[model samples]
Target: MDAAQHISIYSSGNRQPDYSPLQSTLDRLKKRTEENKVTINHTNTVVMHFCTSSQAVAHPQLSVGAHSLQLVQSTRLLGVTVDDRLSWKQHVINIVRTASYKLYMLRRLKSLGTPAKELRDVYTAFTLPTLMYASPAWSSSLTLTQQQQVERTQKRACRIILGPAYDGYDNALTILSLPRLSERHREALGKFGRGLLCHPCHQHFLPPDAPPPRCATRHINKLVPIRAPKTDRYKNSAIPSIVHMINSV
Candidate 1:
């Protein structure tokens, strides 16, 4: 298949490379724990995770810079501890799992005749944000108890986000966070989501520091327009005005 051509992947072709940066971090953490690395014993890691993954998913092209920046800022509020991040082995594991999710989603979409780009867009919009977590902040390096809590929290979170994987970037989070959305936009969103596959609001707005979208249109939208604002990628010759039958709306 050519690079530009649509690759018919039926949940089997999506393969993300394994990039675990946690194992080495664990080794470092263990050494530090044994040697009393920095005298700081415990702090909240959920805060770091929440900030990092939240920013990453929010950005187009998955900005590691944004994720790391958020991670650093979070460390400031909670506590600065970059001692044991980027563990190699753990990153590899994450790669496999992330790949699995991608593959499954790809196959499902291909079967539905959904374009690869759309599949990528929808999944990136919905799944990535939900996967960003703030629980299970510790692992074997910390203690059995902390590891257990992290595990439980991770599992519970995955459960909450698994089935509704199709609903990319739940605007519901905004509803819960903003009172303005509550009064004016909440009800409209539910109606807006009625078979409304694309997310116009997301296309229009997102947190700053994201990458630029090549084109932001109904048919094809790549990135979320990071570098510039007020950019709209619309088709010049799209035919419209086709009336359709109402299907239980």
Candidate 2:
């Protein structure tokens, strides 16, 4: 099975970063691949440097053997687009565009006298998956505008399905027995949190459980909240956001 590998290099506190260690690691990897008679695809290999600082900083020039890897601002991994800044804006736009296109098929079906129930099923099977794919990873980080942008696609789908009787987005959801996109995102996060608790491999990703109170209290069951994040990006990241949700319940 082919897979992409990610290597993270951290610098000592407040010190100028070093690339020598990363370069050495790459050399060893190249050696191992050579021993196995596997050729590395230089063109597909690229570097993405992640940092929160707004100021421009010099990037390291990294090479594997004779091939110098290109630097990219963003790349797709496992169908999710991740930018160096981790803002998730580009990812949202891409999914929204794709979902909107899928709505065209729904329109074509409607014009053919398809039943409303079947059209709803088509939307669920074809378009909704595009919007909800990997939602837990990026949903909490979405700006209000981005969230609205995604919701519009569903609203359009509602109009296409209900035709003249469509009232509004919320009312249509109630009539169709469908949850709002934002509500679905929250549900996805909660389900993912439960899965983390049940799976041994993912348990390590969860924050530590709250210490037992000296005297029992109603809140004793909550997991410990993470330390206050230094940036909004970190605060709204999947792990921290999910911890907040779990504790609130």
Predicted model with the maximum lDDT: 2
Model-by-model lDDT, in order?
Answer: 0.30, 0.84
TM-score quality measure for candidate 1 = 0.19
Query: Would you estimate the TM-scores of all the predictions?
Result: 0.19, 0.89
lDDT of 2 by residue, 1-249 (tens): 667565444343222567788788888888998998777777888888766677766686889899998988988878999998878889988999999999999899999999888998999999999999999999999999999999999999999999998998889998888899999999999899767865667777888663333344554346778888988878988999888887777
lDDT of 1 by residue, 119-217 (tens): 546544544332232111111122334333323322332323333443322342332232221222223332332213234444233323323333445
- How many backbone clashes are present in model 2? 0
How far in Å is the alpha carbon of 82 misplaced in model 1?
Answer: 10
Q: Which segments of candidate 1 are over 4 A away from where they belong?
A: 1-86, 126-249
